[model samples]
Target: MPSEAPPTDFSVARIHETVLQMLGAGVLPPVVQAGHPVLRQAAALFDGQLNAEELGQLIHLMRSVMRRAPGVGLAAPQLGIPLQVAVLEDEFDVDPEAAAVRGREPLPFFAMLNPHVRPSGTASVAFYEGCLSVNGLQAAVARPENVEVDFTAPDGTRQQRSFSGWQARIVQHETDHLHGILYLDRAELRSLSNNAEYSARWAQPDIGRARQELGFLPG
Candidate 1:
């Protein structure tokens, strides 16, 4: 007789249990910091890797963590899950003058799964960007001004959307995480600044001043 097949691993079940344990403890794990091997590895696509209930649990955990971090976006890889999922939201509350200068606008909260983005045009804008995983430092990154994105919704619905300005930047930043790309990979390295210095000197709505001072051209 043929040997018996190996026992099922039930990976999804195990993941579900782990998620519930974290939720049950009432203390979510800290965001994984930079330098973790997981942070550099490309994330796997979500194709029923997690069931509906497990997906909701994971998303809830991510939302809570992102809000606590006070960031506009969070990726699954940032939490060490290595899935192509992220949550992003911004009130877009900058003053009118600053908002107009940056083309910043509000983005309602939504969770994107397996998002793919394409630049709308050749135009690019540069701005200071930060990440929870990278922590404590911000750098100027140039990204396309607008993009068309196709993603699966939290409900497993296929969706396509367009984003411009600040929102466009956020989408690209998070999508890059899924591919193991950090903003630093595309940043003007000389423009890197601690949050304090960023607020003090490079805090303008435009990067023109930082560009002149840091001696690097935006892409």
Candidate 2:
């Protein structure tokens, strides 16, 4: 018998569609959680100037796929590229569609080029967070309820903004990816999802508002 060829990995487009189909079909494949080598590797920085043309393309692509999948957020790593950038729900409390609906207004999409965060005050403890990489699994990660974050805008203009609640969580989460750290590595894995002998699923410094009360936190 001829040797069987290894199954071809799904294309990003196919994976994007599959995620969408699952959403429409009401069956989401457990996202490949941490432990995958891709998730562990540190992502490279975006040195190329993401001009209006490139930024627009990336934003459009991310938004399109994100809607099809109906996720609260999606990172570059999930798409198989190790770029230090991501797009997420800046306003976690609002309906996910709102980001699209609000257009470039109050709830416009966030395109972070190079992000760095600094905390100014004590962070509130909350729980309930999930990762696109870790499908079907969720955890409680403590994050600063509020903080000052400085990052480069898609326009290449430097900007500093203070965000709290769900917004803060999204920024922090994506930044961690740039350093090869997963939410699970930064969340309080031991406290929230503890089982007798097994290792915890979350990391430390978990203080985002993805806690149970948000009611919009993704799984």
Candidate 3:
């Protein structure tokens, strides 16, 4: 007798059942922390891994978690699902000078499925970044100031757009999550600081000050 082919429908159904069960049970697990293996592994492409209703539940769960975590972004790997999905939104609560320098602005919530991001220009900028997974720490990381992003929208439409400034940073960070990359990987390690210390010392939008103080050049 030949070996049986794996039941792909059964697998997808199992995942769907598990996700819905968690949501229906109203017992959402905390976001997966940094040391988890899921965070280190590249997430799977989100090809119909979830049906419409299941995807909605997952997105709702993610949106709620990100907002409550009070974070600007959250990725599926952060929830231990290991799918290439993430959500991002920024309320833009900074002072005028900071907002202007960083090009910060209010960003409505958006979901990215199987996102791909690439640099749109050679210009790069550095900023202090923190993640919900790696709580209580911020570090300086330089990235392309503009990027082109391609992803699937919630309604199942394929989309592509360009982003710049702070929004670009957010997109890159979340996309990196899908690729098993963390800001810490590209961060100027010397510029690492606790949240309070970061606020007290390097809160300025200019990261050059942090580079001077921390004795490392921005990437």
Clash count for candidate 1 is 0
Task: Please provide TM-scores, in order, for all candidate models, with all chains considered together.
Answer: 0.89, 0.63, 0.90
Ten contiguous residues minimizing lDDT sum, candidate 2: 1-10
Q: How much is 124 displaced in model 2, in angstroms?
A: 2.9
Write one digit per residue (lDDT tens) for candidate 2, span 1-219: 122222224444554454344445533233345666545666555565244665566556666666566665666656555555678653345444433322212335777766788776985545556666765555566677777877777777888998766667777777776556777665554434433211232232332332333333344
Strongest candidate by lDDT:
1
Task: List residue ranges in candidate 3 displaced over 4 A.
Answer: 1-14
Candidate 1, 1-219: lDDT as tens digits: 122222223355554565566667778678989887666777777788777987898888898899898889999878767778899999746788778888889988999999999999899888889889887899988899999999999999999999999999999999988877788888889999998999899888888999998888943
Tell me the alpha-carbon RMSD of every candidate. 7.2, 11.6, 6.2
TM-score of 2: 0.63
In order, what lDDT does every prediction score?
0.84, 0.57, 0.83
lDDT of 3 by residue, 1-219 (tens): 112222222245555666767678786568887887777777777888788988998999999999888889999878877778899999847898988998887878999998888899799888889998898899988899999999999888999989999999999999888877778888889999999999899999778788887887834
